[model samples]
Target chain A: MIRAHGYAAQNAKSPLVPFTFERRDPGDHDVVIEILYCGICHSDIHQVRNEWGNSTYPMVPGHEIVGRVSARGKGVTKFREGDLVGVGCFVDSCRECGSCKEGEEQFCTGGATFTYNGTERDGKTPTFGGYSSVLVTNEDYVLRVPEGLDLAAVAPLLCAGITTYSPLRRWKASQGQRVGVVGLGGLGHMGVKFAASFGCEVTVISTSARKEADARRLGASHFLVSTDPSAMAKAMGSFDFILDTVSASHDINALLGLLRRDGTLVLVGAPDKPLEIAAMGLIFGRKTIAGSLIGGIRETQEMLDYCGEKGIVSDVEVIPMQQVDAAYDRTVKGDVRYRFSIDMKSLST
Target chain B: MIRAHGYAAQNAKSPLVPFTFERRDPGDHDVVIEILYCGICHSDIHQVRNEWGNSTYPMVPGHEIVGRVSARGKGVTKFREGDLVGVGCFVDSCRECGSCKEGEEQFCTGGATFTYNGTERDGKTPTFGGYSSVLVTNEDYVLRVPEGLDLAAVAPLLCAGITTYSPLRRWKASQGQRVGVVGLGGLGHMGVKFAASFGCEVTVISTSARKEADARRLGASHFLVSTDPSAMAKAMGSFDFILDTVSASHDINALLGLLRRDGTLVLVGAPDKPLEIAAMGLIFGRKTIAGSLIGGIRETQEMLDYCGEKGIVSDVEVIPMQQVDAAYDRTVKGDVRYRFSIDMKSLST
Candidate 1:
């Protein structure tokens, strides 16, 4: 067993504190990664606080992991010692399942293993995540961190970046298509960048007028303050696709009306309450409300390659590992420009 | 104007009382329909009781209309006197809209004229529906009822039949697909019949164990009692498409879990409360929830022609016009087998 150290929530109501655990020795197809950086996602907050009600205790919550491969077992052909690789939301899946065969292992019928707060296939091993010093994952589940990206900023690509990119790709956001991102936070910022890189006319829709500059700086061509009635009314039935990244409870139907006929509104954020959608909003325009998770391993590699080609990485505010608790508070208040990445090197203290 | 007398609601709290109204004189593009039968939809009841909160008082509520053309103006090219025709939920729409040009006139951006409880474009005329003896509609919106279908049973086709058919057609429910209908009411029964006729393996999912025999009798290849743990567990991760027809709020995420990867759940019923869907349900499986209104005139005619070819019609219990109030009560209690059609000839008294 390999000794590992990280920050973990001892219980649902407790703040994260330093903890230590052991990881299994590398198997034939395993690659041990020295996790260099870990991005703090909104879900990390949700699961650590047990706001979602299903979170396991002693949880080390981080899936957006970026690091260098330290060791590789005999059969680990995908990676070698000192190679840069990444591990996203999932670590292992039943390879025999139909979804795995179709390259959609994330939706494995036999249950894929999540990076944190999840039990392994044996149902006894509690999985630790990227908040720790190191991780050993199967070769198939690990992704290639493309060259030429700020490795700290690229950590969020595993979750926030792929979460936004997969939906935009699925919805066919392309040249000449009008795309709208409904927030300007971690996920929304990536959505704007990806959509713009895809040659789309990107627009940002936000209730806060202050996000306009941030949106523009992130490559959005237009910004519409959703609270402004005249602007909102003028932009109605204009967008071909809308990437909704707001995790709070709001009127989803009001945004559904802004979609053009046959348009789609892809949801990347998970809200606590049910969204109130009027039937007229969807039926009158033939619109759709769909949800998307992080990309599959193959697609995640594709997204990384594309982002690397476009020279894009998440806009991040890097913090030392000890400041994670403070970062959590700032994230809750929506104070960050985008995402927060923890420098795991600081954990040695 | 032509004098018309029929049963109408004076207000939200009023019952069916005798009322008088005027029908427009057959214009150059108009066809005067001599109403024979009208199907009672759950929507008609909702509108009458103001359950949807947008009711216009003194309303006539019916849209599934079947009739014979009594008069056609000199310039009416599509129909002549004595031709059988049907009119569904809509009466008119701006033909120049993108939706109209795409043959989806039901979603016209320029405001499609609803059959009843709605004001016309002129702003003062309260358009009456098939509850009356005659209705004057523009020839373009009138559908040609093909030969061989039982006329009374065909009335529901204008509304329920087209409503189910449009989505099935949109989703391409053909051979080698597993289609699940989630309820056995007016809409569910029609969905089963159509999906079965389309050569797909059809299954009916109902919370009530008693609906099994009826589901099988309606041509369903299988019946899954959703309340039965063993049955639902066995049916999970099996369906290619699920057409949800129940309007009352229920757990949509549970049903969404039953969908195969990339499957879709088309909503035909309009529930008042918004559906609380789990993000994992959609993202992991690439599933979708889409809503479809009733078909346009062109597709309604196509549906009528298809039903005519198959000798298919609704399982309806016909009643005299005076019993509409009682029928509405039974409908609210979910007592009807499938649908109720009012015999318009009884309205002469």
Candidate 2:
């Protein structure tokens, strides 16, 4: 076991504090990553606070991780020492499952081993995430982070980027299609960038009028203040597709009405409670409401490579590891510009 | 105007009574259909009792119409005298809309003229439906009823048949897919037949255990009682596509769970209220929930031709025109075998 030290939440109510832990020794096909910048995801807040009820205590939570390959076992062919890589939402999945075979391992029937607050393949070994110094995982599960982007900004791309990119790509969003990004936070900002990069005309729909400037600067062609009744009414049946990234519960019927005939609304954010959806809303226009998780390893790599080629990266505010608790509070309040990537170098201080 | 007589609902609470009405005379590009059989839809009850709150007084509710073209104007190119034809949920749609041009006239932005309880193109004239003795509609909105099948059984095909078939084909439920039909009534029965004919492995999901035998008889290979928790649990992620024909608000999250990764659940029936859905259920499997209205005129014609080739028709109980009130009552009670096709000749009584 390798000695590791980082920040962790001692319990559901307490904020994250510095803690020491142990990681499994790198074995064959395993690459140990020196996590440089770990993005504080909204899910991290959810899990650390036990809001999802499945969280384990003394939890070191951070999944959107970008780092350098520090060490590897002899069988690790995908990564060399010092090569840039990323660890996303999960660390392992049942490789034999049909979803794994289809390169959609996130939906593996045997259950995926999440990076933190989750059991590993051994079922007894609890996995600690990138809120720490290092990560040891199979080479197949590690993504090759592309060169030529702000490393800290690219951290959230592992989660926020893939979450938005997968749906737009899966839905066949192409040029001339009108796309709406519902919320201008972590996921929506990326959705705007990627959809615009894909040549789609992007619109950001948000309750806050202040997000309009950032939405436009993020490559969105239009901004629809969701709170304005007349604005929402005029935008009805306008968008071909809508990406809803708001985690807080909102009116989905209004969003459903914004889509044109046969249009789709994809939800990536998981609200704690069930939403009230009218079946007539979908039936009237032959519309759809679909949901997507943060993508598979193969798709993650594709998204990274595409990001490199398209000059796409998430808008992130880099914070010191010690400020993670404050960051969590801000994230909950939607205070950040987009996302927060924790600077791990501050952990030693 | 041509005189017509049929059973009509004077108001929301009243039963149907013998009433006289008038339809516009056949114009150029129009055909006068002498109604032979008209299927009673669950929506007929909704309209007659103002359940949808859009019913016009003295509403004659029936959209699943099949008859002979008794008269045609000189410019009628699509139909000839004495030809069998059908009229579905709508009588007219704005031809220039993108939805109409794409052969999805049901979603016309200009609003479609429903066959019953709706106003005609001129806006002032109220349109009566197929429960009346005759229907004068443009040839473009008329569907040619195929020969070699029981005409009465084909009546429901105009509404119930197309409603199910459209989504199945739209979602591309083809050979090798595992399909589940929820409910065993008008829409589900056809869903089973069409899914089975499409070479998909069809499963009937119903709350009633009594539907098992008839489900298999209707071409379903499997029966799943949705109320059986253990059975439902065992059948989790078992379907590639599910056609939800249930109008009552049910557990959509459970239905979403039945879909495999990327599987879809399409709704044809409109629940009066909004349904509760968990975003996590859909996100976990990347599943979809879509809704479809009835097919457009062109696609309805295609469906008719396909049914002709496949020898498929709804399992219908023929009722006299005067029995529509009873049929509507029974329909609400879920007592009909599949559909109730009204024998219009009984109107003379």
Candidate 3:
């Protein structure tokens, strides 16, 4: 075991604090990563506070991990020392399942081993996430970070990026298609960027007109104020696809009304409460509402390469490791401009 | 004007009574049909009682219409005198919108002219449905009744049959695919027959185990009582597509859980109230919830042709026109074998 130090929440009710732990030494086909920047995901707050009712403590909550290959076992042919890489929401999965065999490990039938607050493949070892100093993961689960992108800005791509990209690619949101991005936070911002990069007519739909300028700056050609009835009515049956990224409960029926015939609405952010959907809204026009999780390892690597080619990176605010608690509070309040990528080296600052 | 006689609902609280009305004479594009059989739909009750909140007084409520072409205008080349024909839900549409252009007149932008309780394109001429003795319809909206099937059993195909068949083909339910049919009513029975004919592994999910033998007789290879928790738990994540034919509000989340990754659940039924859906249910497996109305006219014709080839017709209980009230009561109580096709000739009996 290798001695490690990082921040952790001892329990659901407590704030995260500096803690010491041990990570397993590199096994064959395992690579040890020196954590560089980790993005604070909304799910991190949800898990750390036991909002989802399944938190294991001494939980080091982070999944949007960006790091450097510090060490590799002899059998690790994928990554060399100092190669930049990423570990998203999961560390490993049962490779024998249909999902894993199809390269969609995120939906592995045998259950995926999550990055933190989750047990490893051995079922006895607790996995610590990238909020820590280092992480040792199987080489197959690691994604290669493409060159010429801000490493800090690339952190949220592990979660928000793939969460948005997977559904967009899966649904075939292509050129000349009208796409709506609901919410203006972490996931929505990336949805706008990607939809725009894909040559789609991207519209940012939000509750406030104040976000209009920022939405336009983020590549949105149109800004729809959802609170305005006339605006919503005017946009009804117009969009080909809508990416709903708002984690808070909202009128999904109203959003469903916005889709044209046979259009789809994909949800990336999940609210705890059940959403009320009018079946007529879907039935009359043959509309669809679907949900997507983060991308698989192969898809994640593809997303990274695509981002590198398109020069697309999340708009992130860099924060020190000590400011994680504050970042979590702001993230809950929807006060952040976009995402907050934690500088792991700031443990000494 | 052509004279017509049928049972009509004068108001929401009243039962059907004998009433006389008139229909337009056959125009250049119109065919005059002498009604033979009309299916009693669940929606017929919903509309007569104003449960859908859009009923017009003295309304003749039925769309599952089968008839013989008694006369045709000079320009009507599609049908000849004495030809068997049928008309489904709509008589005409704007013929201009993308939906109309694509042959999906059911979703016409200007609204399709519903067979009953709706206005024609002029927006003032009220329309009546198939409970009447005679109906005048354009050739485009009329379907050819393929020869060699029980004519009475073909009535429900105009509405219930096409409603179920549309979504199955739209979702590409094919050979060896596992398809689940929820509720064993008018729509569900056809779903089972079609899915079975398509060489799919068909499972009929019903609230009552009493329907099992009937379900299998209707072509279901398996019957799983949805009320049984153990049976449901064992079938988790097992289906590729589930045709939800239940109009009553049910545990949509539970049904969503039955889908495998990338699986879809299509709803053809519309319960009045909003449905509660857990985003987690759809997100975890990347499942989909979609709504599909009845098929396009072209597709409805295709379904009719396919049924003709397969020797398929709905299992229907033929009832006299005077028994419509009792049929409606029995339909609400789930007492019918499948559908109730009203014998229009019984109006004189």
Candidate 4:
């Protein structure tokens, strides 16, 4: 066992504070990552506060982990000491399942071992996430953080980046396609950057008019104030794909109408309540509403490489480990410009 | 104007009774057909009762028309007098839109003219459908029904057939795929037959065990009682595609779990109420819930020709024109084997 320290919520109602736990020693196929930075995702807040009601006690909630591989077990060939690597939402899955075999371990048949507040496949050991000094994961699930990108910025790519990139890739949003990204928060920001980098004509949609300039600054070609009826009307039946990143529930039917016939709306943000979709919205235009999780390991690596080539990294605000609680509150208030990556070295103090 | 006789409801509360109307004269691009049979679709019931709340009074509702082309206007090129013809949902649309140009006029940007209860392009005239003995439509909207098919049995193909066929073709459901057809009514039965004909492994999913035999008889390779937990559990994460054809509010999210990762659930039915979908159902498996209306002119014609080649016809209960009210009642109660096709010869009395 290895001693580890992290910020954790002792209970759903408690604020995160200093906590200590033990991480398993590197197994034959394991690589120990010395956590360098951890990006806070909306899901981190959801889990820490038990907003989703499944939070385990003493939860170290973070998944967007970037670190240097500090140690590799004998059989681990993918990573060695000091190699930069990343881990996303899941740490392990039943690799024998068809989905896992096809490299989509996110939908593993036996259910995936989530980064935190989730029981491992053994059903006894609870997993801790990356808001800590280190993490131990099988080499198969570790991602090579491509060279030349800012490490803090790339941290969110494990979650926010892959969440948006998976759907854009699946929906084939590329050159000559009109892609609209809803919201301008963490996930939406990455969606805009990725869609633009993919050679698509990217439009940012937001309820507030203030995001127009910010959206354009992030490489979006156009920004539509979603609250503006005229702008909404003009965009109706226009986009080939719409990456909806808003986590709060709103009228998705209105967004559905904006899609061109046979166009798709890919959802990454999980709303607290069930989404009520009007049947006519889908039937009338032959529209589709799909949802995507973070990509599989192979795809995540591909996304990192793609981002490296395109010089696309998240626009992030770096915060010290001590400010995680404040960052969580700011994230809830939508105050962050994009993402907040915690400097884990601050935990040493 | 050409005079025609049909059954129509005077108002939302009134029962349909014998009525008289007139169709526009065949224009340069029009073809006039003497109706021989028309199938009863669930939408016909919804519109007659104003279930969707957009009905026009004294509405004559029917879109699935099979007939012989009685006359062609001067410039009509696709059809000649005495040609077997059919007309499905839409009668006209703005031909200049990308959707219309791509032969998906049902999603016309400038508004596709519906077959019935729709305000015509001229604004004053209300379009009527094929419940009448005669229908005059632009030549492009009329389908060329192939020879050797029972015209009565072929009527449902115009609506239900094209509705199921379009999505299967769009999703590229073909050989080696596992296709699940939900429900065994007019639209679902057609979905099963078409999927089977496409050389896919077809499974019929219905709430009642009573449908199993009928499903097998309709070329289904297997039948699963959807309400049976063991059966549904066995089918989890197995199907490549699931075609939902029930036009009533039901638990759609439960069915999403049945799809293989990256699989799609295509909806052809238009339920009156909003559907509640859990975002996790789509995200966890990378699944989609899409809706498709009936095919446009070109694809409807293709479906008809395919049915002709495969000797496929709907499992229809033929009835006299007078029994339409009872058929509508039975349809609402889920009492019909599949579809109800009205033999217009009964109106000759």
On residues B1-349, what C-alpha lDDT tens digit does candidate 1 reach at each position? 8887778998888888878889999999999999999999999999999988988888888999999999998899999899999999989888898888988888887888899987776866788888888999999999999866778899999999998988999899999799999989999999999999999899999988898899999989998888787878888889999999988888788888888888988888877877777666776677888888888788888999999999889999999899999999999888888999999989985
Off by over 4 Å in 3: none
Give every candidate's TM-score on chain A. 0.98, 0.99, 0.99, 0.98
Which runs in model 2 stand beyond 4 Å of their true positions?
none
lDDT by residue (tens digit), candidate 1, A1-349 = 9999999999988888998998889999999999999999999998998887889878998999999999988998988898889999999888889988878888888888999988887876888899999998889999998877899999999999999999999889999899999989999999999999999999999999988888999999999988898998899899999999998877687788788987888888877766766766776676788887777888999999998888999999999889998999999999997999999998997
Backbone atom clashes (below 3 Å) for every candidate: 0, 0, 0, 0
Model 4 lDDT per residue over A51-123, tens place: 8778788899899999999998999988889999999999999999988999999988898999998878898
Ranking according to TM-score, highest score first: 3, 2, 4, 1
Cα shift from native, residue B176, model 3 (Å)? 0.6
Error of 3 at B328 (Å): 1.3
A1-349 in candidate 3: lDDT tens per residue?
Answer: 8877899999988999999899989999999999999999999999999998989888998999999999999999999999999999999999999999999999989899999989999897888998988999999999999878999999999999999999999999999999999999999999999999999999999998999999999999999999999999999999999999998999999999999999999999898899999999999999999999998999999999999899899999999989999999999999998999999989766
True contacts kept of 1: 0.52
Q: What docking grade applies to model 2?
A: high
- What TM-score do all the candidates reach, one by one? 0.92, 0.98, 0.99, 0.96
For each prediction, how big is the interface RMSD?
A: 1.8, 0.6, 0.5, 0.7
Go through the candidates in order and give each one's DockQ: 0.49, 0.91, 0.92, 0.85
Residue A218, candidate 1: Cα error in Å is: 0.6
When sorted by lDDT, best at the front, the candidate numbers are 3, 2, 4, 1
Give the whole-model CA lDDT for all candidates, comma-separated.
0.89, 0.92, 0.94, 0.91
Q: Write the per-residue lDDT of candidate 2 for residues A1-349, one digit (tens) a residue.
A: 8888889888999989999999889999999999899998999999999998999888999999999999999998989999999999999999999999999989988899999998998897898999988889889999999888999999999999999999999999999899999999999999999999999999999999988889999999999999999999999999999999988999999999999998999999978889899999999999999999989999999999999998889888999998998899999999998999999889887
Between candidates 1 and 2, the one scoring higher on TM-score is 2
